[model samples]
Target: MDTTTWTLEQVKDRISKGQEIDERVVDIGQNTVVKFADNVSAEEGEATMFIARMTSVPVARIYAILRDESDGVTYIVQEKLRGEPLINHLPTLDTATRDALALELQKILNELATLDKGHMGLFGRPSQYGSGILAKFDPPVPPIESPEDFLRWLPHNVRDNYGRDEAPLPTGIFDFSRPPIFSHGDFVPENILIEDGHVTGIIDWAYAGWYPYFWNDYIARRRSTLMAFQDGKWSQMVGQMMQPFPEEFRAFQQLYYRADSLL
Candidate 1:
């Protein structure tokens, strides 16, 4: 269905009667899905368009982003890619296919990194949208001036409980000299789509942003820990897809553990 002409009210009414795909997403049709949120950010839709226009990386196309005036709900209409989440394909994937997928992921990650380091926040928006170890903010954190400022804003326990003086892993562990790069922000198996051993789509851009160069690698490794059923090999596969940052991963692990209670 061509949802290009969909209005907010029309989309809202359709969604009211659409089949729920999940809590926030609805299957308006085989070709379309809509995500609604009371506190929606334009970041996801903008990032989806940005990726489609700027790179060859496959992403779900956004048809419309509408906000209701009567109430504060926002709607994002997007293409529903014809593929299952990569997570579902893991159990059946052969060694050769897994390697091919890794190579594809590497190519995609390299393409995304080529995007200019505009600022340390959401694509086209300076405000931070937390991912990885940081908790999502209600009113997102304002544009950060420096990496140090970003670190300072992290939970005290997350930043300080590592050692003496409650210092973070190491002063220079995060090289602020390196500029932030465009990232998917979340690169777990669930966000990736695979069809016939080929990656068809990369969805969920809520955390997509310009982040520290190592952010993607770090987050992937950290997230793999939660996929206990993946046989603890997800991180290894993630390392194959991109350069692994052992030191950064170690540091983030400590931060993640300290902030685990709060999460």
Candidate 2:
């Protein structure tokens, strides 16, 4: 909260001087700017701050937090861990490692679900989510500036070389038919912290909310779990519980839509 734009080194100095950067200390995606600060002097992304306030509990208890306050916005900051996101484990971790991490994550998720129910959507919490992905993908905002261009890109982007060919997959975006519960709006390996075959922490609560069970389902069952989703047991359960949707969406949407990591 100073009058001039501060470099990362200068801001660190202010934080050290107790200038109110808060307890947040994560420097996520330091190499990239995930958002643009509007305060005329602030940096971008600030996922750190977004994660701090979203959860009712302290980050240390279960996860680290980050806060984005320079732009008059307040949120959590989480330090990036050493290992690759949990997604990396899918390709390499042994059974014990995978199970251990999954259970740990499941445990933490269950704890989150117990928080107050009513305030559980993006509207309820001004979490810095889509902003993060936007910052990461930097998708052309304003809907691609020209509708025609987006339409032009769509066909070639897929070119029949995309989506699932499987006949029966869960369809459409997730609906909130199920009761509201705590949810990691975008729970994926990338946002998780893993160490030595177990989940060390959860990060990026920007999408935390009380939403449809299937949304969480979609994320947990995503590309990272392509093997698991296709597993006979998991597939059969999906068929029993989910409604049908488009085949093209499997790669694009089904990954997260199928996972309901409710607990």
Candidate 3:
């Protein structure tokens, strides 16, 4: 949409009556879509805009971010990707196509890795939105400086379940020195858009931020619904595409499995 000609108020009005593409998304026009909701992560717009500025990353181009402060709703208008979600085409994809996509993912992850500025939260400062990693918290966890800090912040119940031998999250394993890398937190097929054999856009960046590299692998595997589809080959593909932090991931799995207890 043309942000120059349309005001935020106008966008808000249009979104209120827009044709629903899904629960929170609307097809605003032939070339754009609008994602609006009271709980939409504000950082998603920033993430998309940031990725749009990067030459290598294939992400939706955010046109405008309008927050209706009075109603606590946020509207993000962004480019409509040319293709459908990778999930839709995964079953039909050939090995060659999947391999190409894997290579593309490797490059995208490399681009994200370049953003190691030591920030351990969202891309920018003072992240108010809850991430997938800590969404169970009522008020949400804030940015932390170290992995130990994150471990200390874990709920006692989940903490108690962990063995003393675990690294990163457990107290015994000591070295928490890995610098946080920028991650797309949710790297499942549904967030990936593919046209032909190439990735056209990576959307739904609500969980995108700086975190341990393992977060990508663990979260991708943990959150993936690909088990029923392709017999879990997609998850295996993601494991190969991202960094492997098997030790840290095994520890994290225990905590994540108990995440609902925090609620």
Candidate 4:
């Protein structure tokens, strides 16, 4: 299970040779799992591990981070978590269990909010990853100082090209200001683990970082829409758990659509 000196090619070769692969980790036929940080930057690995260690949320324990000196890729070996993702069981849960899950998630969200860095913009380094293709503009999205700054930075041409003409940007939508808070950038059912009606862990911290207060709600709403389209009951259940921010959610939806259209 020792991959302290493995390279990206070496890891891939091992996997191709039938090494056990589970999500981000590659089981090297031993009692350990090797989580490869491929396509993710070193900073992301560092940030994820940092947040995992600091937060009370149940996350995989990091054993070590091995870097390939030649290409500078990072491989994170960590403990494999048990339990199925929340998405798999959401459909079977009754109302009471679902409510309990929601309350637990709310507590986790509140805790995450307390870990804010007091800054704005998407979390993580811009250099480590491109603005998600779904929202990249010409000048590129920068660290947001305020909601006004975020809206102002949207390229006019990009907006004109993909924006919904009927639903204009809400009046004074960006005028309001709220302090930045830590956002689990991609908080969806798939990232949450549950066993016997209790959440065991919340995984995936690649997008964990400080963002505007409304970002987490916005993301949950967006994911809820996708879930609704797939399963109405599940959608309604999740909506109840993670409330909605209608006005801001719609605003962000439009903004993301326009920005993402460019890609």
Candidate 5:
């Protein structure tokens, strides 16, 4: 299956016909897979490939990035990785295996933390469209440089869109002066691939970017708590692997709630 030859209509049709499309990439009856990004610029696809190449962490091999001239949608062809998502197997793993997996996760996180672009903001270059929280708006918000700036930006942006006359007050005082670190914004088990008790690759780079040092740990811990019921060995291992930052976590939660209230 030559993905470069596939048209947007054909891809949509195939998807509608029950083909498995993983993160915009579909396996077109061959060993190869094609990733599609629609109604957006090519920045994200380009950034994902760039980050994959730059990082030491295992990731899918990107063969090429193609764009449809008529619609400006991007397509990425890459090697199909061989592994199951860790989330699917976590429940069956013994404590020892789970602990080993947590160690591997910690190592990956540490390596990612070593990646610093010397400034604060989102991971990729500044563009009109971004992912994660930024994608919630049209003409996406600009990458923030500081936590305080983000704190102010959140309420202002939310209120602006909601036609509110005033921004909400902060629930608590916080110092967001810490330097930014590389963050896999959506760092959950589902993004991790494993085979034979070893991590094979990490996928879904759409939300990778520069964020506060505590952001990755906080989000990962929060998700582990949610997915693992806050009592399982998986949750315990995650807590051990990543230290908790209750203050920052609470602040972010409050900000998120305040912003969500406007909607």
Candidate 6:
């Protein structure tokens, strides 16, 4: 039997079995080739997609499909690119295209800033802390019990960087804690798509959640923290660019960190 080709009858049977196949060839935007023959859904890269759906961000589009389907639930999809990925195409882009891409991304972030709170749904499934609130923020910390101990146990990083001495608090000692916004918790370039000079898609929502907006930056720095960005990994570069977002997005990322109680 040819795995690459399937009859519609075979596909219908497979789908009726609570699954789908690579029954048809689907070329998205421009470059992505999707094959659904055996009742399977869209498969991208080495991952198989199922139960995928698409939504729109203010400036970016979202696509998510289940990456795995063992739970009787498939992963989500929010990405579809028309042209080649930045990694495959970056070296060839003219400065104008590069700048245009960056500026367009910035505009998208700006639109995200004004989003309705309901947009937080973009995060998909929540692990705890009620989705965007982040369970980490509410994690139990051993009591300092006394001012002296409180001074002693303060995280060196927080003390050195976030201390009030260098800068006045943005609000109450906790006022920096703003409400969560819709965040592409796992912001990265692979999850983003650019066609011509404009961003066409924001894919991958498995890690989507209401995080302190700063998470985009934090996720971008995964290389430094996880040692995953060695040897010019494209993922690392994508995460790095996530840092230059405007201040409002910076604020959003900050909340994401706080969601992890890192702040």
Candidate 2 residue 255 Cα shift, in angstroms, is 14
Clashing pairs in 1: none
Q: Name the runs in model 2 displaced over 4 angstroms.
A: 1-9, 12-83, 123-177, 224-263
lDDT (tens digit, per residue) of candidate 6 on 177-232: 35555455555555567777677665544455444444455555542344433444
lDDT of 2 by residue, 33-59 (tens): 122123211211222233345543223
lDDT of 3 by residue, 110-173 (tens): 8878864556665564333255536545444555776555655555423454332222245554
Which candidate leads in TM-score? 1
RMSD of 1: 3.4
Clashing pairs in 3: none
Q: Give the higher-TM-score candidate: 2 or 5.
A: 5
lDDT of 4 by residue, 1-263 (tens): 44356556665565565455566656754344566544555545566676677778777766566677766556765666777788888777888898888888887887777784744544455312234652444445455676555554554435554563322355756435566667777888888999888888777676776665677778776776773347665556546655456787787777767555554
Which sequence of candidate numbers ranks them by lDDT, best first?
1, 3, 5, 4, 6, 2
lDDT, candidate 3, residue 93?
Answer: 86
Candidate 3 regions with alpha-carbon error over 4 angstroms:
125-129, 138-143, 156-175, 224-226
Please state the error at residue 52 of candidate 6 in Å: 13
What TM-score does candidate 4 get on C-alpha atoms? Answer: 0.77
Give the candidate number with the greatest lDDT: 1
Clash count (model 5, backbone only) = 1
- TM-score for each candidate, following the candidate numbering: 0.86, 0.46, 0.85, 0.77, 0.81, 0.45
Single out the weakest 10-residue window by summed lDDT for candidate 1.
158-167
Cα lDDT listed for each candidate? 0.77, 0.40, 0.71, 0.64, 0.67, 0.41
Local accuracy of candidate 1 as per-residue lDDT tens digits, 1-263: 56568898788787888899889999988688998887666668888999999999999989998887787777899999889988887767888998889899999999998987677777776756555545444345655766555655555433344322333445567776777778898898889998998999999988888776678888788777674545755666787889888787787566555555454
